[model samples]
Target: MYRREYKVSISNYPYCNKKVDVKKLEEELEQDSNEQKEAVVYIHIPFCAEICDFCIYCHEQVVNNDKIEKYTNALIREIQEYSRKSYVRSLSIKAIYFGGGTPSMLSVNQFDRILSVCKECLNLVSDVEISVEVNVLNATEKKIEQFKYSRVKRISVGIQTFSEKTRETLGLPLKQKDLLNFINMMGQYEFPVMAIDVMYGEPCQEKEEIIQDIEIASDLNISHISLYQLCVIRGTKLFSRMQQFDWVQPDESMLYAMFNVADDTLQKLGFYNTVIPEYSKYGKESVFWKDNFNPQLDRLSFGASAYGYLNGRTYQNVCNVDTYINYLQKFKVPLDSISEKVTVLQKLERDIILQSRTQVIDTKYLEDEYNELYEQMYKETLQEIIDQQLAYREKNLIKFTKPGMYMQEDIAVKFMKSILEGKSRLYKKMVIGNQKI
Candidate 1:
C-alpha cells in the first residue's frame, strides 16, 4: 500500500509496473479493506469564477479554458484508472458528490462524459444520490437545466451570505438582483434537494443579517440549508486583511447567539439539523454526508486537494492543480500521503469523535464490544466532559449540551492521547480546532 504523495516526481511513464500507482492503494484495499461494499464518491472541481476573500480552500481563479481542459482529461483518466481496480469495481456506490471550487464551472458535455464514464465502470444504485455543488454567481438556469435531465439529484449552492454589506466586506462579487433572479429562475425546476450554504460570525457581521438570510432562503422554497461559521485561516486574503486592519470578529457570545438564532429559525421553518450546520426537511438528509463519514462505508475521492477515507486509510491529494494533473497524466497516484487507520483504537476514535460531533456516541455499543479499549481510550475524557456539564449520556448514546456544541473542539482534543501516533499515523488532527460547524 506504499504510495507517493503526488509532490514526489520521480518517473515519466511506465509509472507503475502495473500501469497506475494510484491503483496500488486500491489493490491493497482489495486485500484488507472492510467488508462493506457500499461507497461514496467525491469528485473535486477546483476552478472558481473568482476566489472569495474569506476562503482558504484549494482553488485557482478561472483564467482560461486550457487549464480546465487539461484538468478534466486528467480527472477522467484518474477515474478510469480507479475503475479498473477490482476493489473499486466490487463496491456499490451510495452517492456521488461533485464538490468544488465550483462544479458548475464544468460544461454540460464535460460533466456528462465524466458521469458517463462513471456509469460505464461503476455500480450505482437505482436511487443513488448524485449531488453537485454550485456557486450562486454561475448557478444559471441553463446550467441547472442540464442537471435536471442528468443523474444529478441534489444541488447545493454556495451563497455563503446574502447581506450586501457583509458581501462587500468579504469582497464577494455578488449582486442582490442577480441572486434573486437566479433563485427565481432556478425555482422552476423541482430538484429533490436544493441547499444553500450560509456563513455567520464573520468580521462586522450582524445577528439579524444571519436570521434574515435563513428566513429568505426558507422563503425561497429551499429544502436544505448548511450553516457554517466563518473561520479565517492564515494565508487567505481575509486573514491578511484582518492583520492589516486589526479587524475583530464577533465574540464567542455573539457567535453563540448567531448559532441559536439560526438553529431556532430553521426549526420553526420546518427544518431539522440532520447534522451540525446542515438543516433539512423530512427525507432530505444529504446521502454524501451520511455515507461519506460512515464507518461502514468507504469514501473514494478524486481530483486535486480532495480528502478521503478509503479502506481504513485517510489520504489527501496534493492541493496544487498542476501537480495533480501531472501526476495523473503521468499515470502516477496523486495522493499527497496515505496514512493507515486500520487499528482498533484508531477505528474507535474515528467513529466516536465524528459521531459525537452532531449525533450521539453509542457508548453502549462500544462498551459491549471494546470494553477494555473504551475504558482506556475515552472513558476518562468522556466522564470529565459529562462532569463538566458539556456532555451527557443517554441510555446508550452521548449527546452534547448547548454549551458543549461550541466547545466540542476542546472536548474532542481531550480525546487525543499519546497513543499510536501523536500527529501522524492514525492520529491525524481533523477539525480539532474551534468547532468547524
Candidate 2:
C-alpha cells in the first residue's frame, strides 16, 4: 500500500492525519501574521452552470441566482475581514487567483465587484498577477469584456479533449461553438497567460484526437497549454462510468506514448512545455505556480473547500457551502482542518518534489541551506532514479529526463521509498522535526 502511494501529489506531502481546531488555527494565523510578509489570495466559487463527472474539485451545479449572489457576498466579506487583519494589512499581495467550480458562474459585475473590493481593501502590488479559472459558459462577449482594463492577467479553461465521443464519456457539455467563441473573444485580449487544460489517456482516446485538440487550441492564441493525464478518482461519476467500457482502457505504456506524442506535437508548434505539462509561449509562466512554493508568501484561500498555506502550516476551508456562509455571516472563520507545523526537512522535501515541475534541482542550495548530509542522501536518491533512466546529474544540478517528466508524481514517490529504505537518519529527522530544525 505504501509502494502504491509513491505517485501521490507532492503538494499533499507532510500529510496531516490528526484533527484540527478552527479556533486554534485562527490564533495560529494571528501569530503567523507577523512573519507573513507577502500573500497570494485565492477565492473559491463552488457553483457551476453544470458539473463534469471526472472532476474531484469541490463543486456543485448552480441551482439558482439567489445561491450564487449569497455566496458572492460571503466571499467579499471574507476578503474584507482578512484585509483588516494586522498580517494581511501589513503585507503586499503578489498574486490573486479566482479558482472554482466555475468562476464564470458569477456575473461579470459580481466578478469585477469582488476584484474591486480586493483592490480597494488589500495592499496589492503594481504588478500583482491576478488569474481566474473559467468554464465553457464564460465564452460570451460579456464575460470576455469584463477582463478588459481589469486586473486579471491570466485565464485558465478546461478544454479536456475535443473528440465528441470522448466528451460524452467525460460528461462535458457538447456545445463547442461556445468554447470556440469564448477562446476567440478572449484571444482578442492579451492576458499575459491564457491556458487551456487538456487531458489524455481516456477510454477510446486516440493520438490524432489529442493532437487536434492541442493544435486547435494553440492556433486560437492560447499562451499556455496544461496537459493533464486522466485519472478517474474513485467515487466520481466518471470513475463508475469508466468501468462500463468494453475496450481495454489506457495502461502505463499507452499513457506514456500519448503524453510523448502530445509533447512532440506541441513542440513542433513552438510551445516550451517540455519538463512539466504546463507549456507556454513567449517565455511566460503562471505566477501562482511559483508563489505557491515560495517560503515568503502566504496563500490565503477563501470560500468553500479552498486550500491555503501560511507560516509553515497548510489549511482548508469548509467544503459545505451553506455552512461556510453561516460561519462568515457571524464574522467567524469557516475552517475544515490544518496541518501541524511543517518541519525544515519536510520543507526541503516539498521544495525538491515541486521544483521538479521546472525539471531541475539545485543540489548546492540544498547542501548550503539544510546540511551536507541531506544533500548527499538526496543525490543518492537521484542516483537510484538515474539508474532507472528517469533523471541525470550534471555537475551540481539534478534534472529530469523525458520519462521522468511524464511520471513526476511517481518519481517523487520513488524518492520517499529510497529515503525509507536506506536513508533512515534523514527520514527519522524529517518525521521528527529535530536536530537541524
Candidate 3:
C-alpha cells in the first residue's frame, strides 16, 4: 500500500522540455556516425485535408498545391544537407517512417521522388522497414499501390472508430461503410502489415461501439490493431468542449474495463500485445517505434514539427510550415528546440520509467550496464513496488501483473517521486552535517 496521492499528466511526463546544448549534439552525432550505429529516420507530413479538433500534434490544413510543393523541395534540400554532415553520412539507416496528418495524401509521384532523394543521400540499409501512415479516406487503391512499389513494410491506418455516433462526435468525415470498403481493398494488397488504429473513451462511445470496432478489425486480415485511450489535451478544442459540456474522462473504473476488454479481445484474436495499445499478429513491432521509445538508437527527423532523439538529446523541428521551409532554404536546421545532454541519472530513470510502461525492467541488465547511476534509493523504490505487490521480480526481471498494467503509469510516477524526494532529503542532511563538522 501506497499512501500518497498522485496524478499522471502529459506535462509531468519525462518527455517534457529539458536543457539544450547545440555543440554537444553535434559532437555526439559525429561520434555515433563514426561508430556506424544503426539509425532511424522520420519524415513529417504536416498537411492534412481537415484538422481534427482532438489532435494535439502540429499540423496545418492544406489550402493549395504550391505550399505542398515548396515544402517537399525544402525537405529534399534538408536531407541533402544532412548527407553532407560527417555523422549523418556514416549512419546506416535501418528504418524510415512517414507519419503525420496523412502521409498517403501525397501523390505516388511525390512519394517516389521523396523516397528517391532519401536513398540518394542516406546510407539506407537494404532491408529497411519503411512505414507510412494512412487516413482511411486517403487510403486509395493508387496510394496502396504506391506503397507496394516503394517497398513499404507497414501501413498504419487511422480508423479511430466504427460507430457513427462516436465518429460524428469526433467529427470524422466518413461512415462505417467507408471503412469497410477500405478494409476490403486493403485485403487485396500484399503489404507485410496493415495496422488499424482505434480509440476508446470518447464521450459518445458505448462499450458495444468499441467492441464492434475491434470485432471489425479482427475480422479483417489486418496485421495489427493499435487501440488508444483518448487523452484530452489541455489546449485542444476537445478540451475546451469538455468544459462547456461538463464532460469528464471516463472514470478509472470504466477506463480499466475498456482496457481489459480490448486486451482480452485482441489476445483471443491472435494479436500479441507487443506494447500497451499496440498489438501485432506476426509478433513484429515497429523497429522505428522501438528504437525511438527505447531512446538508445539515433533517429533523425525532417519536415515541420517532427521530433527526434540523437546522442541523448531530444529535438523538435519548427512547427510553422513556412518558417521550417525558409530556414531549410537558408541552409539551417529548423529546430524548435534541442534538449540538453541528458544526465546519466536521468537516463537510468528514463529506462525504468519507459520499460515499466509496457515491459519488464531487466534489473540485472541495469546493474551491469548503469551501476554508477543505479543508486540505493532507486533499488529501494524497486523493492517498494514488489513489497506492495504492484510488481513481481523473478531472477533478474521485474514486471507488472495484468491488474498492475492498468495502474502502470501511476506506479512508475510514484516510485520516481519517492526517489527524487529521498535525494532532496539526503542533500539537506549533508548540508546540515557539514555545518556541524
List per-prediction Cα lDDT, in the order shown. 0.75, 0.74, 0.74
Residue by residue across 217-269, what tens digits does model 2's lDDT show?
Answer: 87787878888887677688887877676534577777778888998888888
Candidate 1 residue spans exceeding 4 A from truth: 1-27, 30-36, 418-437
Task: For model 2, give the 10-residue run with minimal summed lDDT.
Answer: 1-10
The lDDT of model 1 is 0.75
- lDDT tens per residue, model 1, 20-139: 244446568556334548888999999998998876678999878788889899889988887776677778998999998989888887888888887887888888899999887776
Error of 2 at 191 (Å): 3.3
* Cα shift from native, residue 303, model 3 (Å): 1.9
Candidate 3 per-residue lDDT, tens place, 136-221, comes to 76667988888888889988888989888888777778889988898788768778888889898888566777777888887887
Candidate ranking (lDDT, best to worst): 1, 2, 3
Pairs in steric clash, model 3:
19-340, 20-340
- In model 2, residue pairs whose N, Cα or C atoms come closer than 3 Å (at least 3 residues apart or on different chains), thus clashing, are 273-279
Ranked candidates, highest TM-score first: 1, 2, 3
Measured against the true structure, the TM-scores of the candidates, in listed sequence, are 0.88, 0.88, 0.88
